[model samples]
Each structure stands twice: as structure tokens, then as C-alpha cells.
Target: MHPAGPAAKVIATLWWVLLGGATAIFLFVAGLIAWAWYGPSGERDEWGYVIGLGLVFPLIVLAALLAYGLVVGERLLPRPGPDVVRVQAEARQWAWRFGYDDAPDRETENVLHIPAGRPVDVAITTADVIHAFWVPRLAGKLDAVPGRVNVLRIEADRPGRYEGLGSEFNGPGYRDHRFSVIAHDAASWDRFLQGDAP
Candidate 1:
């Protein structure tokens, strides 16, 4: 799947980095095991190699990964901007409701409309049980807890439709708790804002 925006792109990058690192370590360990089991037992001092690779390497990699994750997470936080679009996302039972701050009375269920190439901040909360709003191609999952608002920033690189869902199971209808994000171009997005589209 294509990553629709910067946050997803960063997450995708980190995923690949983690995967590659883990694969490399696995292969190295496997090779060491094979050598120890099959090769001739010689008086070789390889304790340093084992300790360095098994302990020091993982420690360094984990620290670097943590730092990178924090940096990316900070970038994903919602920032006040003149051009930023704000929307309210409410979860209850097994449905999602989206409301635009610009048009208080206008609301959409299970479908969110946003402008492409612009930052959109979604203030997420739950009316009942806890849930998680997740759009893999757009951004990471953010928990929606009762009495708490969690804001997440999402953007589309281009005009398209992306899939979203309630990642946390709350009730029997949780399996159907899916949503779609429709990203429109500047002109079409303006028309949507003008209440010209349903």
C-alpha cells in the first residue's frame, strides 16, 4: 500500500529499518550457531565478537531506533497553523462520527473529507468505550478514550480515497467499524466546504 503522507512515510521507513536490522541479526546468529555446531572446535577467542554483536549491537541499534521514533513522533504532533484544517472525530459503540470545525452543523458518519496537500488535525475522543482510530496509509493509530481528546495530524499527498478503521474492539459491531477518508483537490475541497457535495 502507498503511504499517503509524511507521517505514514516515516513510519514505513522505520518499519523497513527495523525489519532489515532484525533480519541481519537473525542471519548472523544463525551463522554463528552453524559454525559452532558443524565446524572444527579450535581454540579461538570469539567471546568478544559474541558479546559485541549480541549485546552492544542491539543496545546501540535500539537506542538509535528509539531516538528516531521520538523525532518522527514529534513531527506528527498537531501544530497550530493558519492553513490547518481541524475536525472532530468521535467514536461510540461501533461507529465513527466526523464533524468539521468550520461547519459545526455539518457532520459525516464513517466518512471523512479533507483537502489534499494540507495538514488536517483530527481531535479524537470516545463517547463510550475506548477505541483507536487508524488509517494505515495516512498516519499511525491514536487511541480514543472517554473524557480525553487526542489530536492526530493527517494529510494526503494527493486526492484519493484511503481506508480507516477502529483498531480497538469495543463491541459486537466492532468488526464493521470502518471508515473512508476522501481527499479532494483544492477546488473540489472548496466545493465540499461550501456544502455542495454530500
Candidate 2:
């Protein structure tokens, strides 16, 4: 499936760019090898072409990619916004607990509910060993460490469900450490906050 929001979209774009660049590099090197084996012997030792393609081109491409990556990463960071919602994610041995900042008493296990078409800042930490919160369709993964709190911002383009899990290997129950993200429309999200739904 395609990415649902801006952050995931940026990541997807970066992935495609990397794949294309790698493929191009591979083809160029392969072509050079073929030419060396089968083309005119006198022209096979072209220093200028070898140096330019093997050194200069890669350096330029790598520098450009590094700059592009930094720009995309900066865009994905959590920023203060008027309608931003905050949630806290706590990780244990093999389970996840989500607490809403707006409704302190309301907590849910293994299911995160948020409003669609808006940004959500998820504060993540671990009660036990380290874990990683990863929801592929929405945003990138963030580490959940015992004594550290990391915030990851995510958004859903529409009302739907997305899967998430602890990406890092912890212990015996690591494989079962899974969760779901449920995105609701504005009214449904309000009702959820007001405790009208379980």
C-alpha cells in the first residue's frame, strides 16, 4: 500500500531515489567492465573517464543525496501547530499502552486512536527493555528507551486502520508485540476523547 501522510510519503520518495541511484551506479560499473573486456584495447584505459565516473560522479551524487536527506528529515520533525494532539506511548515487555493528554484518565491497550487530517505527537518511552515504535504507513520508527522519552509526529490522510509493532528484538515475547492505529473523523475522535466509546 502507498503511504498515507506527508512523513511517510517523504520516506517513500527517499527510498525510490536511493534505489534509482544504486541501480544507475550498478549499470555504469557493469557497462565499464563489459567495455574493458570486449571493446577496443587501446581505448579501454581511459583515465579521465574512469576517474570522472568512479570518483567525481559518486562524490557529487552522495553529496546531493545527503543534502536532500537532511532537508526531508528536518521536515519530518515534530513542530508546534494549532491543532496538534498529544499522546503518550508506554512500552513494556510485550505490550503497549496509549494515554491521551487531553483525557488523562482514558487509556487504551494495543490500540491508538487519533483524529484524521491532523498531526499527532506521540511521546514514546519504555518501562522495560528498549523497543521501537514503527507504523510503516504513517511515519518512521522512534526508539523507546527505558529512561528516555522520544516524540514522533504522525498523521493520517483519512479515516482508516494502520498496523504497528515493536521493531527491535527484545525477548521471548517480542514477536507478539503488536498494535493498531485507528484514525477517526473529527466527530468520532471528539467522542473518543469524551469517553463516549470504549
Off by over 4 Å in 1: none
lDDT digits (tens) for residues 1-198 of candidate 1: 579898899889978877877787677778777887887887866797578766677777778878887887787778999999999999988789999987777899999999999999999999999999999999999999999999999999999999999999787888888999999999998888889988
Colliding pairs, model 2:
none
TM-scores of all predicted structures: 0.92, 0.95
Kindly list the per-residue Cα lDDT of model 2 for residues 116-153, writing each as its tens digit.
99999999999999999999999999999999999999
Model 1, position 2: C-alpha lDDT score: 77
Clashing pairs in 1: none
Q: After superposition on all CA atoms, what RMSD does each candidate show versus the true structure?
A: 1.6, 1.3
Predict model 2's lDDT versus the native: 0.91
- Kindly give the stretch of ten consecutive residues in candidate 2 with the minimal lDDT sum: 40-49
